[model samples]
Target: MNFNRKQYTEDDLLALYRGILLPRLIEERMLILLRQGRITKWFSGIGQEAISVGATLALNPDEYILPLHRNLGVFTGRNIPLDRLFAQFQGKTTGFTKGRDRSFHFGSKEHHIVGMISHLGPQLAVADGIALADLLDRKQKATLVFSGDGGASEGDFHEALNVAAVWGLPVIFMIENNGYGLSTPNSEQFKFASFIDKGPAYGIDTLQIDGNNVLEVYDTVRQAAASIRQNPRPILIEAMTFRMRGHEEASGTKYVPQELFEKWVKKDPVENFEKYLLDEMVLTSRSQVAIREELKSLIEEGLDKAFAVPMPEPNVAEELADMYRPFAPALITPTSPNTTEKRFVDAISDGLRQSLEHYPELVIMGQDIAEYGGVFKVTEGFVEQFGKQRIRNTPLCESAIVGIGLGMSVKEKKSVIEMQFADFVTSAFNQVVNNLAKSHYRWGQNADVVIRMPTGAGTAAGPFHSQSNEAWFFHTPGLKIVYPSSPYDAKGLLNAAIADPNPVLYFEHKLLYRSVASQIPDEYYTLEIGKAKLVTEGDDISIITYGMGVHWATRLLQTMPEVSADILDLRTLLPWDQEAVAQTVKKTGRVLILHEDTLTGGIGAEISAWISENCFNYLDGPVIRVASLDTAVPFSPPLEQQFLPVQRLQEKVAQLLKY
Candidate 1:
């Protein structure tokens, strides 16, 4: 527990010295590699080795660590071989990612080291989710995420910190204040004096330390981390370091001032630490020199091995099609595990409960659901059963909620993030869309998290509240979106989302969350993800809709004469039912796509495009789209009704029948 143990062995001092020498030597070799044509461009972690090394030593090996690009010292401390790292720099077969991931692209499922993100600010949000999972699983572990002072300028950092603070997520937010971000300096990046001050704004305890002082950095961070373990909230430790190397191998260092360079070199982090160790008698000067030589030899050996490693054979069989799987049209067949008869929202609630029971690492936390049973009672009595540790209430900070959930999910955790109102999702778009959605594709790490948002326009929430933005995610890759219309579909798909390995955005229509009362059997059940359900068996036309729109479209179909509409509720939007849709369109000879979102691009356009391209032979009429009017929804009842799809449903039905 005590970081400064008053005395230490030669091995400990040598290890500390090695951490610095390795990162620094590697930084120089990176430049050599660039000049020697051994590698392409590179991003540097130079001049910031002090805190990374000290912080790594301070943390428990079992704890999760998510680092940004300039975290070489941390990686070295965690035992990532310098040769392997250099191989990544050279983009070779020996590269941990086999030429797929970028240099500094690092993750270890076994070591619990979460992937380092390329973007500066986004990873902070994911750190929260990872920590939440660790806590929910009752693991005696913590997570540390490193960011830069300049990264604080991003909205995601604020989002992540706020959520971690509000929900008491256990994690460390380390700011390596290296004065500059690429070409822009820290002062120009934000109005705040420092990143540490910003942490206090989010209710997180902040500590500013001399990042280059190994003992001081370790002592300060250790105390801060201990406090977080007890309170289980967020803590920000700003470590003042310098970026001695260029931002990357391609960067021109000519712009750096001569005076500043001289001053920084004189106060080199590695040399300074080495001198301190000698003064303190932790290691003699001879031993320090010997260790530095040893580090140089180690680096040389790794570099040689990396060069000697054979290139992987290229496979002509590996085509572009192997990159990803496109969504297909398929019916989500009911399975034995999801055989329970329950309403969609209830199924979601049960799925969450089941997930809690299934994965000890699963943690559920959000704005409210604890005692109030959620805004729609989707999580009624969950806190009583799971305890506050697993089910927690957060302040009204959507950014924080999602950010923290993201943090926990990336590490050894599975977080189920809940947004109280679907409309509130706009506040956390930075975290949800920019951070969680792209975490995996960008970093090659899986963020197994679920964001449950109660969506649609039916509850008369009016204007600011009612909107279907599924099109936003449907258009994006690396994110899975599921919108369920029925209790049965809801329960099954939600369970599937929970069990899936990727980040999933689960949209539960507010209208359907509690709309229908059905006899839900007390049994386990789940529907397959990315699949649709055929609610009706009419062959004249195919009505493709989801959430509340499916119910409304079905009602209109029942009321309209001669319109034997084959109703289809798309359970998942990202990997939607392309096969079932194609087959249904071919069979029915007509297709109509409906949703509660605005008519422009509201999932309907995609369906229409697919039908026109794939089912043109069977088309009797142009594909029609029934959705909320393009105008902003009105708060007034009459205007709202007119703007919504409910009022125009009959007219659309008549038109479809005529077609």
Candidate 2:
């Protein structure tokens, strides 16, 4: 059979063959190394090289491509140095992630490549954010995101597709259906006949093709890119292919039918493409053998260079230093020429409005936020004031929306993501904890986002709505948590969080929104995120609390004047005011930790342990803690009141004072 040429030249065709050949040769060599114990592990892309290579080549060099584990062609096509890639596989300091993360789990901003996380589906939504940024900037570029039959089952897949269609984003969703998802066949994965049908369901253009055909894959993607440039919208491509090896080097392929392997081996992409090129007179057998020898020598030289590089040193300082970008929370005094009284919700609105005015790259997104002003009316007139482009409403897809915010951050754009209620953030926990929180630590990428969490349990919103889940994120190493008590702190700390370069969870108590008012400055000001405020002064006891607990402590102290106590409002949770806690502990010799979260495994536990360890010598009595009962927040008002620690706090304060 002879080959027919269209837009691409003879040289372009030869380059594509070389692109497919490199990954196959490299993986074959790596498997030998794996047996020799030179490399740790490998996710072989031996068979599906055409999809990664053709799709990457289809887009402009500047456009972004999010590659899956098997897409070695994406790297080699971009001409990334083989030495650096081999070093990354070997977990050396010269790798993209500095050996922080292994395998093809790292991204390179210079190459416009966003690498995949273990959770494959979330990257689809993150691609939306990247495309959204381009749309907002009117850039003529599209994003190509890769997924598989197994990963397509994740909720993020549906959410990302629907959102991309609604927002008119330019993204190419590539699904490589390789028959098995780590031993589970596609037969058990989804009942649907084809992923192509999903495109019409979401109003996106769909294409289905044989993934092994290199020329066909290249032509189809090239046309899709051209269509998106003229009319920006998402396109879904389902490539039917098969992986010859196991999921990883260790997992054997006994689960796969031997007949299936024999059938696919005959239709091998590399061998078939070589045959077609020979028939078309694009190359002779002599040239093909010479090319293989040259590539093998190159791979050997690159492996030698990578092997000579040293491994990362094992030390606390190095580990800690790589965890976060260099950042120092601002500390501004509350002194201003003018001040005004405002409610907690109004203060937050003011801060957001002022931040939008201050930062050109800042955008706010959440459900019911654009026209409806969110569930709480916090952004009542934001859409009109800032326009729809900046203040946008999102579908009820928490995980994808947060992933979108992360994608925007990757392009140096700051985002304020509102989780309608703090409880709903659970749906997006993987994106927040694994992707947003760990992006900077794994690589030198900044996830400049401030997640607004409407929290607390005073309202009768029940178990689903009322949850003070700050403790859930407090344990995460790469995130900052801030829970403000009053309007003044709310406005200041929020601005501070938006300004900080790391991912921050800003918790706003639902009960304090309209009930509490304070005299705040008219102009914008920022307070230190790691700093604590001394609300009241005393000499006998110390009341350490935050959010609604601050108000509870104040009410108890006002009622009992005999108990002269110091009230310390911990405006920030993750980077809590340890210095203030220790100082107050030494001065009073009595400490009472208070919070609205449940008692077991709460933030109070960490504070109590810290006080016990650091201030053990300064203790006059046992460290006391008063927190809500360790159970789901009840729907009944009476039970909720009983479950809360308002009454229990009074008893604990009295006991500590007596001790």
Candidate 3:
């Protein structure tokens, strides 16, 4: 094969040859370990190492690369220790993730690599966010993200491309078209002649090349990197290759035809690259044989060392807990006392303003968040003040945008993402529940992002717009859920959520935006997350509620002179104040859990269950729950009112008092 000597020297070609040889040798060793029951699984990149090595070498050392399971050559090209890779496969404590994750799901901050989850498509959006940070910092760095042909069929793939195109981010979306997505062939995946053909529709440059040829892949990526650094636009490259093995070591190649397997074997990237190096006189036959022997010895040594490493202790869970400990309250210089009264919407806006002024790395993004200042106007004038660099307006891709926030958070940039409506959060549910909430536990990385959700009912916005969806996230651990009912709490908790080191679901009631008002301090302060407020002290009964339900309970309490109920506003739902609830329940000897969310599987049920378990003897009556009927919010006023009837709440309270 002809090569470009100017683009790559003999030394570079030899290194690329080593890159191809190392992964193949390591896979053979790992397969031995798998058979010996020392390792659980193996995802080999036997015939596709050329693409990973070439692409990694094409970018700057400091540039980021998010690799999928099959890109082991990228790790080798980055000079990550072979023993560390073996340690991860063995689930030893010396692994990249400290034995928290297995297989190829590990990354290094020092190497500028973000570890990937099994859901392959979300990383593209995350790469976009990394590029956004580089652009904001005015740096000349680009991010390379790898995904399989099967992952391209996911919605996140298209959403990521759309966002990258619209923002003109410096990202390279590299697709490893290895002919098959697990057991499914590429013929059934899509109808496009080539994956690169779709790049034009997304306004991105495209390229398709022989992935087995190291020189060709390297030259193409090097040129693409130069253009991207100057122009800052996304590029799509589809590298044609083949997976020599099945998806994993255990998954045999029975589905693969013998002819196709044999054909790929003939064009094996490692063997072909070695032959090219020998043909070009870059390496002699003797040197090539020595290199293969050296790689085999190195693999054996790495496996030996990794086998001696200790497994993670059971107390490693405690270490994980310590790593994910709640962030302490932020210290702030109060400019003024609580002398200024403000509405809920103004309070939220002021909180955002304070956050932007305090944390320079704090970024706010959502649909119409930049120029339009969001649909609810909570972020009005923010783009003008903070500029579009920090305050970004994103495409209407909830999953991609949330994924962007997740990526930025992992890179140490705190992000606040707004979902125009709480209901729309369902679109990004996987990113939230799977990626954001489980990031720390899965890979020991914190997703320090706050997702602002405008929620609740009363505007008759119907099922789509009005929803009390806190229950959905409340069930998910590794996420903080905060729903403040008053302006003071809103301003304070929003600041807390932004400063928090964990992912927070900040639920802002849309109905209370204009209706609720309170005196809040002009200066910045963060309310303690997971703590409830004692709105009133009463000896009769305790009413635990959040969001708009707080107002309903308070108003109903005024009408019932015979029932003096202690109103407790649970500002943060996920880690609810058990001590506060216990004290209130002990003092009153009765409790009523109320919420605007539906009756089934509501947070009220959890609170009631806790009270029954912990304060059963203190209770004067059985714990009662008053919530909306188990149905979607209706469009009609009367039906909606009937669904969440105040009269039914009154009757429930009366009945509880009688009990």
Candidate 4:
């Protein structure tokens, strides 16, 4: 984004510089502690100080901050107690991290700094999501996320940017481009374009700034943040900087050349800015020496106090979980919908209605989810019952939609995010892959959240609309994936997803929502994640599948009436029921695996691998497999029909029967 010349006052620069020095002093003291066997370990963001200090200066204390590992400057500058902060590094109970995560990964909710996330990309998307919530609630809080140059290259980075750009949510994406991306440089990360140059492709405004320039970095960030708040969309700021240290404390930084290290040391913001202050006569040599001494004293005082504080007694974790449980409406129960025959749409509608009724905090968001009744009417008439405050229909920005939901989840605890179509979910891929999947792993934070995607191929929607994306999330950690073949399981799993401590990526087979039915109870119920259902029992062979493929396998079983075939439908993808599958494989002695997802790297591959490793000895014959041809599910009715899993069913079944 273009900006007029803006500069900070001399005093403002000194204060920011002082903020930098305090964090460095703390980091250095912690290193000494680690070497002295006085602390477990510490990861200091030594060389990376300017952006952390400067970025904080750009936003107000009320504005939200999502910081990464090297965020001592930002956290300390924002007024997180130096002693409490250092205590956390020492693994004491009084430490900011509560002794849960490693040092340098805690958050101050009071300072409007959200909890620290261990994994990358999750916080970036959460920052975007929080900004969306503030906009919806008519508040003025904008969000900023600080990441290293390495995280920008991950798939989640692109996904988060795409969503932010499309929706124009008020969020800033700051990349601390410190030369190397953990051994890979910018050249290898993006061969097509520079990091900032690529932002426009996603309709985002981007800036490449000198990270070491305290004034330039602060002024540029302030401008970008202000612009985002006014216009509302994603902004990317690439701060060209260097790593004064290694990836982590244990990393000896052997990766950096001596020459580069020397060059960076000369340009260190602390030394250079101190010289600038002295040259301008803004502060005298006596004052500078005093400032240095102040830093040392401040650090020592912080450490002495932190070590004396108690560690979080074990019950802290349990207490946190208890706080998440709902009270009045202990579990979500359905409100009677007059409509009957149980269409998939009705099931989804009931689920929404019930969730809105039960949970005071439940939020529903998607494009055209309001008067338009959502693309498939799953959320039809929800806004009327729940009001716009609860059921939020948003602009068509899938990535941003998910990101916005993430932010809301952080602030409010639970939210339901519906991607218009499963295929369109690619628009918000970053929020799903990076943010949702990694949030808990990184920060010991939990998102009692629901992500609904209308997935699967059928009815000739073609390549764009007819797609199943569960396999993508299946590979990601910290995300629980649910794929239900029937209305009963769909509703059951959705309820469970909302109650889950971690984020749940729920895929609703677009075709099954209205067209399918099962004996769902009128009473409240919940299903456990990582549990597989044994649909049918047989002596001949076992058909292992989930979602639509379960129905297809059952259909194929009808053709082979002479052969007794058992079916195992895995409900959840991540942490799937390995023991059940191994048990089924042993019982049937023969197995045929299937899924509607594509063949290559599909969910089937995982099931197959699991069976190979654990169920291999029990197999009477080679584990037969059935899956859609490794091709983009074609849009044409006839071609799509041929392209799906039907063609492979007979072959796989025959092979399993023979075995």
lDDT of 3 by residue, 1-659 (tens): 34555756778888778877887788777787788888888888888888988999888889999999888888888888888888888888888877878877877768888878888888888898888888888888789999899999999999999999999999999999988999899899999889888988998999998888777888888889899999999999999999888898788899989999878887777777777777888899899889989988888888789888988877856764744544667555467665588999999999999998989999999999888889999989998889888898888899999889877875689899999999999999999998888777766678889999999877888999988899999888788899999999999899988988799999999989999898889888888888999887788989988888889988887887877779999899988999999999999987888998999999999999989898899999989899888899999988888787455888888888886
C-alpha TM-score for every candidate: 0.86, 0.98, 0.97, 0.71
Q: In order, what lDDT does every prediction score?
A: 0.74, 0.91, 0.87, 0.75
- What ranking emerges by TM-score with the best candidate at the front? 2, 3, 1, 4
Residue 72 miss distance in model 2 (angstroms): 0.9
- TM-score for candidate 3, please give it: 0.97
Looking at model 2, residue 560 earns an lDDT score of 90
How large an RMSD does model 2 have?
1.4
* lDDT, residue 119, candidate 1: 59
Q: Which lDDT value does model 1 have at 371?
A: 84
Best by TM-score: 2
How far in Å is the alpha carbon of 246 misplaced in model 3?
A: 0.8
Better of 1 and 4 by TM-score: 1
